[model samples]
Target: MYDHRKLGRELNLFDTDPLIGAGLPYWLPDGALIRHILEEYIRSVERQAGYRHVYSPVLGKRELYEISGHWSHYSDDMFPPMDLGNEQVVLRPSLCPHHAVMYRSRSHSYRELPLRMAELGGMYRSELSGVLGGLTRVRAIHLNDAHIFCTLDQVADEAQAALEMIRRAYEALGITPTRYRLSLPGPGGKYVADAEKWQRSTALLTDVLERFGLAFEAAEGEAAFYGPKIDVQVTDGAGRESTLSTIQVDFHQPEQFDLHYIGADGAKHRPVMVHRSIIGSVERAVAHLIEQHGGAFPAWLAPTQLAILPISDAELPNAAALARRCAELGLRAEIISAERGSLGARIREVRQVPYQAVIGAKEAADHYVSLRLRDGRRLDPQPDGDVLARIRAFVDAHGTALWDNAARHCPERKS
Candidate 1:
């Protein structure tokens, strides 16, 4: 089994300390780089998809979740409230309520229907020690969460689009869903009391799934507290199945928050809330990614995209120059000097790097670099401009191949 906990430690990606508590791990330098790249990629995708990003505080007033119904149904999973003078605040377990409040802050017109708001925000969960492990089950989570406020009529299309976005993101991230699940509230579960709202939300999700021709199972009791959702499930190396992405059509929150938009008919109408997460939580996503690739991430997501190796002291200057050029071209390049070890040893050490640019005495004299790919393929020495251009192209395209000839087209790149 490819366990992220083991691989993460081996690669110096992330770690947990007793003082910081279990369930809360801090990303090492390399891990933080990967996370930053993933975040920027998600933000770019969301921006192109018409989502306006926002930053919301991690703590919310206790009354906020109470109004959103999390206090009534999900308080067990939430941290205890902090008494701040007369007001009490709690670390939010979810981002929807904060987003709902943001929506209600101002009135909206029909033209602004389907206002998509996104945030890569932090939230906390109070998990029992036994249930917490690595990044999968954590106390602090930075979720890739978003909410779309659309009219009731636009619910199906908005949901379908969100599912398509998730598919594209998964393809780019190299994630394969074990199955799609239509998660419904199980009997006796802590769900909203409105049966009609539940039925309506479930039907909308079902219609979207059917229209997309995706085979899914209706699983009772797997839903969010307020609504049913289409869950994209993935299995870890330990054979534990969990949802990595979701799209939920929620009519409950808008009503609870008294959210409204003026319709063309000059009447204030309630807008439905469409909650979507392309990547549910950054920690878990990166954990799965670490295991999926066994820490050899794709070029775009790799902590160090290119490793410039100098065969001897004579080639160190050339290696440094090449590294600087790579940096200017937006590649994360590290120069592994000959002082570290022999060329073979350094090559073995940086095997996870996507591209290895070797600067030997002969190549340095010729102003060329011999390319060694992570897959162990070597190419003839190429000029500096040619090497950097090819590497930049691959990284920019976010493709899965070391070279264009073997590249798999990423759907997200097309968008």
Candidate 2:
């Protein structure tokens, strides 16, 4: 396991300063790379699943949460509201309610029953000061949040599709099946009072889990206030359980929000809402990555993929040129050519980088460079073109590790 504080400093990922209040984090350039890369992967997965992406404001009128019952059930976890000329606005604690409003943006029909909406929306919540932790539990979070509007009859199939997606993500992350629990709620639970609806939903989820031959642990009443859900829980290096993903079936929201569409019989029908997150929060996932990989990120996700070290100042120009070519190939590159340190010390610093390109007089004479691997293997780099191709292929191999487990398993193939 990695010490988050030490790794954060070593990599310059983030820092907690007196000016940056507790529960709030400031991402450095390196940290932003991880964040943005994660968002891109989530977007790709959503697009593959036929989800229409949407953006919602960071704050909304107080009534939005109130209508979604967040005001009553989760008000304590919310940032206080601001009073603006008799209008009350609050930082959004969740994106589900906003997505609910979007479902009503246009009149929909049975033909559009399963309308999947996805977003990587930023959100804020006010957790107790004592409960806050770096990345794992932060006040600001970006969620791979999504909601699927399906007819009552389509709920089972949609939820199954979501489960499959979740499974694929976990597997790709090298998360062993035993590390997570796919939990569902039971009938007559505190979440919903409708016995028939609860029974049907629970049974549908059970069948899906069994059909996929996926193992899950069912919690009799571990669900959201308005619905039943399947959660992906990971046991941290400290053996503490944390939720990495969630898939909830909301039976009450459609009625509460008055969401409707024309049925086959031309009658009004309510659409079931499936709320899900492949990686519950980007912050938490990064925290997990740190601990899981022990701060030695895989080649693809490393902030600085290759650090170029020119042994002599005379080779600086050549090293710089090679760095530029690597950058053009989409590989993050760093060059160090100062004589303040010995060659051994310079090479030792190679540990800070997952890959290294070493330039020296001998290499320049031979028209080759020394390539250092994370595992201590050294290969002489060939021509610039060959080096670029090798680096590209190495990146391609490591890029798979950067994906959500699901997409990693069922990689997107070109049509």
Candidate 3:
């Protein structure tokens, strides 16, 4: 029964002002901080897994989509053309074509067969206004987008490695959903123009999944226009299911884009293409996070990790100094000026922030801070560094701003 709109408003995450067109989100400072944390999380995971960060254009020439078959299958979702001097440009619907352009920038040898490129690419899509819902569905969104180019022989290991990274991501986000799906696009629906290639690619993916012991359901016609995909789905709190991650197999795109790699055989070979988003789209994931956690974020992901409340104006400076120390240790902290309201009212406000540090004149004078845990465990007065260390340890263990006292608070599951 957690209303996302109300929570979003109260938390200052984002809003849809009537003045701004619908489905276009304007993230407030708090929301932007969360976005940075998410992006950094993905980037850190990707880099450790050998992905090179890349930047691709927000729009591309019409020829790019025409080559990739998006112009025919998904043109309606694209923003209308922009006349760029002599060329007609359309906003990129996906990151594959641009990634292909990156591949073609240089001739890669067999040693570089599995070149992984990742981007936090912002994209624009003209969605029907009626279908938009907060961050879950939006016209403009950014993706945790990535593309992998691997030799046909190397596809399985590459795919499995991608899955490992995704698993780490799920753990980091504190999501544990028992049911997972590997969606193979329904053939003959969108991008399977070559029957022989489709059959081989699909079979190759199936074998890869079997060899990896990964279970999946074949989704006939669900494949992207350029390839077949394995979609990762998680059921939300209300028994509604949605995609959380995806790994797509593409053979046609290499041929369509004339991509090539020098193989061990010393000849040109078309490397298989894998498009993956471990966390899917950020907007969609954050929306799902709100739903999954019922708006109670874990410590690591909480926008405001530690809210400080001083008993009176005399203690504000001390609380502010402690908050600064918290920030230096990579924790987000804010101090409520004591004059804003009564100490009890302040504590109520502190609960809304998930974690709070209460400062009284005695505690401030003693150079110790009182911690009010989310689950009602209050530590009387402790050293500032010790309190900060405990908070960091809790956040580190939970990966997000989640309370570690699970015996007290029941953490949500995706289903």
Candidate 4:
């Protein structure tokens, strides 16, 4: 069994320090690179899909959450409030209330039917020490969060678009969900007590899923206090099922915030709010990828994409030049110098770079390199420029099959 904790240490992705408190994981350079790539890739996708990214405060006045009802509903799960004597505030557990205030900041007309705001926002939630796991279960979180405030008539269309985004992400990343839970309002008092609003919200979501032909089972009482939701449950390497993605419809927040926009009839009307996360917590997604791929990331997602291995000190100059070229082309490359370790010693199997090029006098002289993939496959000797082009094409395609994508196209796997 491949444990993410062990692999995370081996890869130097992140570590938990006791002084920093439990669930606070620190990122290393290599790990930060991977996180950077993930955010860049996902942010690009969001921008293309008509989302406007915003940076908001992670700390908020206690009154802000109180107005949005989180203070009453989830005050225990939230960090204790800080009293400035004049006023009190606490770390935000979610970005929902802040976004509601943002929407309230602007008075809009019917033309702005659907206003979408997005962010890779940082949030905090208080968790017991015993329950805190790796990055997957943490107090500090960066969420792939977005909110769509739209007209009532726009609900289905907006919901469909959100689900489509989730589908595209999961497909490109090779993630498979074990099941979908239609988390409707439960019998418990945890949910908002507006029976009519609950019925309407649940119906709208049910209709959207049916239209998309999605399969899901209804789980009573699994919804958020404010809304009905679609929870994607993925079975991890350890066979533990957890929800890492969600599409939720909230009628409570907008009503509570008294959010309104002008309607076609020139009258003010409340907008229905849709809250979603294609990838819930960014840290958990990274942790999931670590475990799912066993730290053998896809070439596109790999931090140090290529390793320059010079067989002897004689080829050091050539290796350095190759690494420079890769860096200039926006590719991450590392030159494994002989000063630190042997070529064989540096290639520590799975933890090594996804691609390695062994350079010697002859190959350096020829100005061509034969690439060796992590799967032990050798790409035919090609000019440095040509190899870079091929790697860029794979990255542009969001290649998810890892080294296999290269091996299948190559002549053979090298020992």
Candidate 5:
């Protein structure tokens, strides 16, 4: 089992310090780049699916959670409200109420049945210190979260659409959920006591899952206080199950917040809200990816796609120039300056770098670069333009690894 925490330290990805308080892990440049890529990728998918992203403040007034009922049921899991002279506020533990406010910002007609709003936003939760071990469990979390407000009749279809988006992301990342859980409110529990609404929401989620042909187990007392949810469980390399994605159907929130849309009959009707998170937390997902590939990321997601190594000081200019050109072409490239260690030793230091380009006196004069993939496969000197093109093509394809023949084939040798 590859421990992500250990790998995180080794790769200089992220670290926690008491100066900033526990559970608040700060990202290093390399890890920050990886997170930026994840966010951009998910954002592109959301845009294509008609989900408009929004930004909201981390602090919300005390009344916000009270209106959403989080204050009644989950206040212990949230930060203590701060007294600000005139108003009390706390870091938002979830975006639900704020999103509800957005929906209430204007009146809508049934024709605008489904309104999908998304955010890659931060939230703070108060978790016990014992559970705050790594990126997976922390006080600060960010999610690829969204909320869709639609008519009652559109409930099943909208939830299904959200699931499809989740599937697209899971497929692209090569992460598969091993188990599906349909979490429902248990009898006489912390959940809202709306029997009719619970049954209706649970039924809607179940029907959507059935339509999507997903097998799931029903877990009692596993639901959010306001609604039932579909939780996705992925078993990690260590054989431990972790929940990284979820789709929740909430009928209670709209009612509590007095959210309504005008119906076709000109009467007001409450819209069903479907809440979802594709990658539960950007930080945790990066940690998962670190373990998945053992720190050697695929070309598309690797921070430094190609590292340039010069044989000596004489070739530094050529190496730097090649890196600069690659960067201009939108490929992440970095130059490893001439150093005291053997070229091999220096390359080993950044072994996780997807590709390394070595420029020697001859190669520099000829405007060529010798490519060495992370898997140790070496290729003959090729024109600088050819190398960059190959890299760009691989990234365009979202290559799962550096190359199909990164470890075996010599491009110069025929099959």
Candidate 6:
């Protein structure tokens, strides 16, 4: 079985320290690069879809969660509040309350109804040490969270769009959902007191699922404290299932925060909140990706996209020039010196790198590079410009294939 915990350490992706406490793993450089790429990709996708990014403090006043009902419904998983002079604050467990406060900061009209706000924000959970395992169950999380404040009639459409967004993200990231789950409130749970709100929220999510023709199983006791949600479930290499994406319809927060927008009739009306996440948490997403691809990530997502290997010390100058060119194209390239080992040994060392450009004596003299792909395919020596452009194109397209005949249109002849 391919466990991320094993691959993560072997690849130097991340590590945990006793001094930092359990359930909190610090990301190494390569792992941080992968995370940064994913974050940038998500932000661009959300921006094109009209989400306004925002930043909120990681700590919130204790009363904030109380008003959002989290304190009453989900405090067992939260850290104890810290005493700060005349007031108390705690690390936020979720971002919805802070967003609700942002919406209430100013009055709005029907035109701005469906205002989408997004954040790659930080939050904390008080998880037991026994339950903590690698990135899958971390105390500190950076969530790809967003909320859409829309009219009651717009909830269904907004939810459908969110689901589609999640699907697109899954395709690009090479993630396959195990199943769709309609998470609902169950008996003996700390659910919101409003039965009517729960019923309405559940119905909204059900309708959305049915309209999408999605086969979903309604799972009880899995709903968030405030509302029911559509959970996109995926299994890891060990066959352990977990939720990676979610879409939820909430009515309680607007009421608790007293959020309103003037309608076309010029009267106050409560806006329904649609909560969604394309990638639930950066840590979990990376963990799954690690197991899914077995540490061989796609070109764009690969930490070191290209490794420049010099066959001998004579080619170091040429290799350095090629590296500079790659940097100019916004590609992450590293030069592995000949002093490390033999050329063959060096190639094996960076087998995880998607592309390797070998600058040998003859190739350096001709100002060309022999391209080596991770899949063991080698292309004949080509000019530096030609090779770099091809790499850039594949990375930009987020392509899975290292060498696509149609997209790249290079000759099949090998070195």
Higher-scoring candidate on TM-score, 2 or 5:
5
Residue-level lDDT tens digits of model 5 in 88-173: 99999999889999889999998987899999998999999988877888999998899999988888887888889888777677
C-alpha lDDT (0 to 100) for residue 193 of candidate 5: 85
List, residue by residue over 1-415, the lDDT tens digit for candidate 3. 4555667767888888878888988888888887888899889889988999999899899999998888888888999989999999998988888999889889999898699999999888899989887887898889998989998888878877877777888887877654556555563445556777767777767776777677777666667776666777876555767777888788877888899989889999888898889998888887777766776677788888888888888898898799889878988898887777987887777674667778887778776777777656765567667778877887777475434454332223122
Better of 5 and 6 by lDDT: 6
lDDT of 2: 0.76
Of 2 and 3, which scores higher on TM-score? 3
lDDT of each: 0.91, 0.76, 0.79, 0.85, 0.87, 0.93
lDDT-based ranking: 6, 1, 5, 4, 3, 2
**Which ranges in model 2 have alpha carbons more than 4 Å from their true place?**
171-178, 182-192, 338-340, 397-415
> What TM-score do all the candidates reach, one by one?
0.96, 0.89, 0.91, 0.94, 0.93, 0.96
Question: What are the RMSDs of all candidates, in order?
Answer: 4.5, 5.9, 5.3, 2.9, 2.7, 1.9
lDDT of 4 by residue, 1-415 (tens): 5677788988899998899999999999889988989898889999999999999999999999998889887888999999987999899999999999999998988798799999999999999999899888899999999999998899999999988988888877767778888997667666678989989999999999899998999998788999899888887778888898999999999999999999879899999999989978889888888888788787788888888888789889999899888888888888887766766687664244677877866678877777787877776766666677777777677867444353434333223
Estimate the TM-score for candidate 4: 0.94
TM-score for candidate 1: 0.96
lDDT of 3: 0.79
Over 4 Å off, model 5: 404-415
lDDT minimum window of 10 residues, candidate 6? 406-415
Which candidate achieves the best lDDT against the true structure?
6
lDDT of 3 at 157: 83
Q: Which is the better candidate, 3 or 5, if ranked by TM-score? A: 5
4 versus 5: better TM-score goes to: 4
Off by over 4 Å in 3: 187-189, 211-214, 396-415
Clashes of 2: 5
